[model samples]
Target: MKIPRVVVGMSGGVDSSVSAFLLKKRGFDVIGLHMVNWDAQEEGTSQCPRSKDESDAKSVCDRLKIPFYTVNFVKQYWNDVFLRFLENYKMGRTTVPDIDCNRSIKFDIFHKIAQEKFGADFIATGHYATTSFGDFQQNRNDSQEIRLYSCADPLKDQTFFLCTVSQEQLKRAIFPLGSLQKTEVKRIAEKEGFHAVATKPESMGICFVGKRKRFAEFLDEYIEPKPGKIVLSNGKTVGNHKGVHHFTIGKRINGQYLEERSHLGYFVSRIDAENGDVVACEGSHHPDLYATRFRIQSPDWIPIRNPLEELPDSEILCRIQRTHPPVPCTVEKCETSRFLSVIPRIPLRATAPGQMCVFYTTKNECLGGGEIVEIQDTLV
Candidate 1:
């Protein structure tokens, strides 16, 4: 009888560190695999930020008496994840790169390497999501269908970012932090002598931005600035912008050329990428900033079946961003099968093309999601 081997994607973060430790305690032959998705040298940085992360990951693996290895996915990441992200921004759309990274690199390439190269039975991560296998993965059956579920902690649940993962990928995936809360994970890390990891601050926003103070400045390096008019919905030109790409829907309009004439700050309502026009609304709570209906590309359901076809009567919840709570939505078939129209019970704010609209059941099961293709109707 051989012990099942599992490769954990140790990211030097507390959540993943605790995941590797919990798996080892559960009797799996664990190995730590660190992925380098970016090369600092390409950005003209002398000191590679990943170097410290690699060292920390190695330290955790060494303390746990497990084999540690590092793989560079910089090329793959730039091609698959970063390129798509930049393309979306250039088109005046807000996209989630982490979702792309998971779809392309972490689950796809990392899974292949873990199983083919390491000869492992399973691959695990620190994601705060679970599957039909149950929390801690105690229940298992080869014939059973796998459905992604929200973690124990809703605030930390990461199922939104993982909606694109296929059934095959979710089948062999292990999430040790699924049943635990953020505070609990930190406590466990500290108890296990991972002081550095336990005390490390959480990583937020886009990873490629690093510690840059201005995100617009970072984007300017890649996208050429094309000055454009910032107009109100009523054809009132209140300001000018460096580029339409510099603004995102629902964000407050800010720049030197803008006239702050409104008592309420002006917020972006739309980006007309074709004409380089950025439309603004008067307030954060402006009706123009709230969307009630949108069209999305065909969804990638977890069980490989379109939920609209399988369970038409089932209640579906839609979420545009991870932080936003899932709201009741009605999915209607469009004229062409390539897209679907979604009408939420409550209007969603700041939704734009290129954002992923993840679906969920009332029971908290993630039904997968698709990229938002168009905003059909606003509250106004």
Candidate 2:
């Protein structure tokens, strides 16, 4: 019997390091593939640089006695993920680039290379999401569908980011850290003598963007800042902002012009990109912050062969943001086949445009997700 060759995405972090270690220990032909998605040299960042990650990844592979290769996906990430991210931000929508990066670069681009070039039967990552194959009666051939489930660690579950991954990609993907908690992973890494990365801090913020720079500073490098007026819901101009792209829905507005009302800490309700105006509302529970209905575009359903035909009038749980809990919702098909209307059982706050709305079964199986294109506040 031929040994199954598994290509693991090693980020030099504790999770990926332990993933590679576990796969190799399971008697599989494991190879480490480190993706270089960002060039830290260009940004001149000393904190959490890609070079350090690459070095750590290489070191882990050496310690594990496995072959390691670095693949540069900087151009691909910039073209596929970063470009779309900027476009969404320009439209004044709250975009999650991590979702796009997982869909386009890691599972799509890297998966292809791992299979065709590296002769890999499976590509594994340290993502905290589980994949299971289950029979689907909805299929004409009674085929099995790949279902994504929440990781054992609820606090660290990343099914939200993995929601955009397709069935085809999930079939070839493996997540070794799905059943383990962060503390357990650290213990295992330490026990296995991978001490350097066992205690390494997890990377935060955007993936490609180093920790040394602020998110707005990174965006300013690509997008020219357009000064805009910040107005209250009553249409009173209270302050000026650097750009509409700098603000997200529900984020508190802090500017020099609004010093008198600074104690109140007004929240952003809308971004008029065309006129360069950011609309603000008073409290966290402000009417403008809640949305009763929203429209999702290009929803990727997991098991259903035809989502439009199967999902109309269907009820499912919906998660509007990454960390937000799943809320009961009804899906109403729109006139256009490309869009679906989602009405939450209760009003949801900050249903920002461009953010993903992930659907799930009652049993916690991730059905898939779509980009939120429109929002309707019943109070408004």
Candidate 3:
């Protein structure tokens, strides 16, 4: 029987270079593949040009003696990911495009294309994740099962983003860099003599579909900045804001314009978009971003009825976003719907809507997560 072929998603990055190299060393027929999320002509800039990244990826494939392929996923990305992102920001919600990109483009689009077009038996990425199986088989049933594990490098672990994968997809997805530290992976890549290994800086922040522009720039084009009053919590006016969309809860703003402000420091507490208002709360101290409990939405179903069903009530502990680790708490399922009332472990700051609040245990098992329900205008 022929060994199954694996197509590693190589983005001209060190991690992916290492991924393809390691798979080849393991005796699997491996190839490097790149996906073009945006066409350079669309943005009039080629910072992340499709042709360039593919060329770079192909160079590594040649050195590694492997086949390479390029796929155009631009339209799907704009419709499925970028459009959703724009809609979210319009509603005063901060969006995580990377998570959406992972769900719709990477796992869904890449996996399907690898299997059908590339004839790839398996798909791999340099994502900091794992392809563990026995971890899910404890139910005493299926012989073949796949469970995603945390990467050894806590700083780089992306399991939080992969939380949405279905059981079937999870089984097919492989993450070779999960168990190894980032340093070790870099060492392996250098030893393998792969080009672009040392200078492959990790991409961070938003996934703008290769649009090299700031959110303000994008939003300015699509959204009109309505002027609003920045009022203190005591109903005193401090200064004016360009728009409510420009500000968000928890962000501290300078109060140099305040005529007689005590601390002369202020922070965002509310964004009244409907009335074109951005309210600022004045104080000496800032609100803690940490919360003991928070409601999560867009939950990834865990095959069982729902993990939250295993909870004492419908409520569970949660961490509002990627900034902090998860903590313990319980919830009161809102009187009428999927909404949950989070009684946090402690009083914390700015649990903004549209931001994810992932749940985990003090024991560190990710109990799945969801986007935060709206936070309040008043400071706790």
Candidate 4:
């Protein structure tokens, strides 16, 4: 029996630690990877998050007695993901840097390093999603396709985030933690005797800038936060929001930015960067930000042979964001099932630009997903 080489992305967290341990147990060769995406100064810490994360990964690798490697991707991240993140927001469109990170860094760049440089057969992560063969794969389509499925633990499922992974990446990806619950993952890490297992807490918020008090402070380092006024759709100045950088479309409930009582718990309808104003309306009575008709372009999920059946008798259900619930929707139009306009059966909430719109079959097979380019009636 020969060992299949695999590279495990270890972030010094419990999930990735267990993933590495499990793959090794299954008789696969495991190499550990830590990506350095930001400078220590940017994180305002003695060391950057990725550096610390890599150290944790090194500890896991040491315990497992596997080779550990680190790659500096701060420049790449700045050009590929972070710049796009800032540019999109300046344009008043919300962007998901995580999606870009998957496209450019994790799958594209990292996959190349794993295969070409490390001579690895596969790259594994702690993501809670299962990689399986789809109908296209069974039938042997022109380009073999891969299916991404939700994890057993619905509460901790990260399938939505990984839906953008291409077929090639999917074929070479392993998610050992998909079948295990988060608690079980911790247990496995402990049983394996990995020290970082119990020490590190989960990392969250914009990768480098977590617990930094305010996003304004973070952006101030790069893009100066322009002072903005909070107003109604009619341009009635009710109050002043901190800055244009601090708001997104459809910020309801707290409405903390709108320091005025006239709003009745307002929702952010639109943002004007030129005028530096965020338009608001009553949250309850506001028109749902969820679009009845939305377009998805250049989808990564279309199988080469099947061609996505442009005019299907069936409709597609989509979740525009990871946290947002999926809603029943109809595909108004499809181009090789690539570009599609989805009309939801009911009103949805807070649809923003630069976010991922992930579609799925009722059986839980991920169909495909794309970025939100533009939104309608998003006036400021």
Extract clashing residue pairs from model 2: none
- The runs of at least 3 residues in candidate 3 whose Cα sits more than 4 Å from the true structure, single-residue gaps closed, are 42-51, 134-145, 209-214, 254-264, 283-285, 288-293, 303-305, 311-317, 376-379
Q: Rank the candidates by TM-score, best first.
A: 1, 2, 4, 3
**TM-scores of the candidates in the order shown:** 0.97, 0.93, 0.86, 0.88
Error of 2 at 140 (Å): 19
Q: Please provide, for model 1 over 308-375, each residue's C-alpha lDDT reduced to its tens digit, 9 standing for 90 to 100.
A: 67765347899999999999889998999999999999999999999999999888989999999999
Score candidate 4 by lDDT: 0.72
Query: Residue 204 of model 3: what lDDT?
Result: 63
User: Weakest 10 consecutive residues, lDDT, candidate 1?
Assistant: 41-50
The RMSD of every model to the true structure, in order and in angstroms, is: 1.4, 3.2, 3.7, 3.7
Q: After superposition, how far is residue 268 of candidate 4 from its true place, in Å?
A: 0.7
- How much is 345 displaced in model 1, in angstroms? 0.3
Residue lDDT tens for model 2, 240-301: 87888888998887655363475567888888899999998888778888889999996887
Reference-based lDDT, each prediction: 0.90, 0.83, 0.68, 0.72
Q: What ranges in model 4 sit over 4 Å off?
A: 45-48, 133-144, 252-259, 288-290, 305-315, 334-339, 377-380
When 1 and 3 are scored with lDDT, the better candidate is: 1
TM-score of candidate 3 relative to the true fold: 0.86
Task: Please give the lDDT score for candidate 1.
Answer: 0.90
Model 1: CA > 4 A from native:
44-48, 312-314
